[model samples]
Every structure is written in C-alpha cells, then in structure tokens.
Target: MISYVKGPLVDIFEDTVIIEAGYIGLEIHVPLSVLDRLPGIGMETILYTYFQVREDGMCLYGFLNRQDLRMFKQLISVSGIGPKGALGVLSAMTPDDLRVAIISGDAKAISRAPGIGVKTAQRVILDLKDKIDMADVLPAQFAAAEGPEISAGGVAKEAIEALVALGYSQTEANRAVGKVEVSDDMTSEDVLKASLKHLAFL
Candidate 1:
C-alpha cells in the first residue's frame, strides 16, 4: 500500500494532479476540498493517498488532510455508497454538516446532492450516524452561480476536449473546472488536476 507521496506538483487542474517524484509522474485523484487547499503548480506538496485495486484498473485517491481521508473512508463504508458517490456527498456538504444532518435526520438536505435520492439519503444517515462526529463536519460551500468558460486557446481547450472524449458532458467538465478555480495559465496537465476536483462536485 502506498501511504503517501511527497514531490513536486508538476500539474494542477480541477480533479487530478501529476506529482513528479524521482523522474516519474504519478497521477493522483483529488476532491474539491483538497484542490482548494493546494499551492500553485511547480511547487512541492504532500498528499495522503488511498489506493483502490480492481481487476480492470487501479485508482489512487489523494487527500490534503487525514480528516478528509477518514471522512471518505467512513462514507464509502455505507451500503450503496461507492467512491464516486462518497465524493459527491463530500463535494456538496462539509463533513461536519453531513454528520449533523445525519444525526438530526435531515434527509432532504442530504438528498440535495446531484445523484443522491431521498431513500439513499436516509440510508446514508442511518448507516453513518454512529461513525462520524456531529461536531466536526462543517457546512459545505457551494460554488458561486457562474457559468464556466474554457479559455479561448491552448491546453485548456485540449483538456476540455479530453474530458469530453473521456465521457464527461461538456457542462459537467466546465462546472468541474469552474469549481476548482483553475486559472488560464495552466496546461492540459493542470486542467486534468482541476477536472478531478470538479468531477467530485458531480
């Protein structure tokens, strides 16, 4: 198990990042909460990681802090919650707010996440109530109501096209980039990082 990584951040986009360590670039998936906390590209960074192994592929989840990782682990333990689903919940609500809603039985609020339904929301509450601290999860900050725009030229466009080619809807890709606050100066590599975080939002 790869516990963590410490290296230069060669790229930063919305959802994923490429860290260069010992001449190899490691791709790591990230959520918006962690994306928001990252320093700019070409700098050094450290991330705690969770590695998921499957017959078809291998995936890496990167977290900026232990608390987020712990929350993620707790989320995925609930029945019907996969990594993607757990990420969706975290993207929409802070860990504290999620716990409070669960403990308080606010299914409506939990159901507000894009893919979650009323029954699933209630299930999440019932399953996780004992595992999380009601006092620790904070209220999540929804992105401002603005349309995302792909910059007019270069790698940003390529990145968007790549995301679309990879089966993401244009609106979804745009929203992901927007949610991550990706700047115009980045390359496609950076855009991928931004995309990973934005994907979490969806």
Candidate 2:
C-alpha cells in the first residue's frame, strides 16, 4: 500500500493535486477541505494517502492529516458509502465535526454533504457511533482535561453539542469549553457563548 506521498506540489486542480516526487508526478484526489489547507504551488507538502484498487483501475486519495485519513477509512467502511461519498463527507465538514455529528445523532449535519441523503446520514451515524471515541477524536489538550463533568453529560456536554452544531471541530469545542469557568447556575447557552469567546482568540 502507498501510505504517503511527500514532494513539491506541482499543480492543483478542482479536486486533485499533482505532487512531483523522485521525477514522478503523482496525481492524488483530495477532498475540498484538504485543498483549502494546502500550501501554494511549488511548496513541499506531505499527504497521507490511501491507494484504492478495483477491477477497472487504481486511484489515490489523500488527506492533509492522519485523522482525516482515518475518518475517510471509517466512512468507506459503511455499506453504502464509497470513496467518493466519503470524500464528499470530509469536504463538507472537518473530521472532528463529523465525529461529533455521528456521536450526537445529527443526521441533518451529515446530510448537508453533497450526494448524502438523510437515510445515508442516519446509516453513517448508526454504523460509526460506537466505533468512534471522543478521546480519539479530540486533541490531547482537551482529552487530558476530560473529567466526570464532561463525561457525565451535563452543561458541558450540551455546550459542546451546540458548538459542534455550529460547525466547530470537537477538539475546538472541547478545548474552548474547558477553558470557560462553569458555574452551577450557568445554562448551556451561557457556556456556549463563553466557549465561543475563548475560541475567537485561539
């Protein structure tokens, strides 16, 4: 398997990039989200790649981060989702947001992706909910601070859910909310607003 590609970014098309490595230009299909984060042309970049082989031919799909690559793998593992469909999902939302959507059973969020219907979104949630872990999806800073308050599903959990609904990554939501000073009198909305203020400076 071709695990990764590292080279100068020679060209970037609508949904693909050409990386020149060892005198060979490798074409890699990437999600729109990856393209948004790519460096300028001629800069060296590394892409975690998945090589797909089928009866017709072969292709390469690349991601900017290992987490995105892992999410792509998980999405494709679903019965009705193919590589293209999985890429569409990644293009629509960050991997962290996708994980939150799955965990929260937010089919509408998943269905926002092109070519993904409500039924498919539900299927994605149903299939991947138990498979994903908040610790695995959240950044180390957030995961290290996880306590009974967040785990036990209270105002913190509700705040995180609201942030996720607003398109923030789970890591971003978690870290931001963790930084906020919570009180017994605070509502989920208060926590969310405080978290947003914290995230704005980050």
Evaluated with lDDT, which candidate comes out highest?
2
CA RMSD for every model? 16.0, 7.4
Give me candidate 1's TM-score against the actual structure. Answer: 0.63
Q: Evaluate all candidate structures by whole-model CA lDDT and list the values in order.
A: 0.70, 0.83
lDDT of 1 at 34: 75
Q: Across residues 54-113, which tens digit of lDDT does each residue of candidate 1 receive?
A: 899988888877777888888788888888788788778766556556655678888998
The residue ranges of model 2 lying beyond 4 angstroms of the native Cα positions read: 147-202
Error of 1 at 166 (Å): 39
Model 2 lDDT tens row, 35-76: 999999999999999999999999999998787898899999
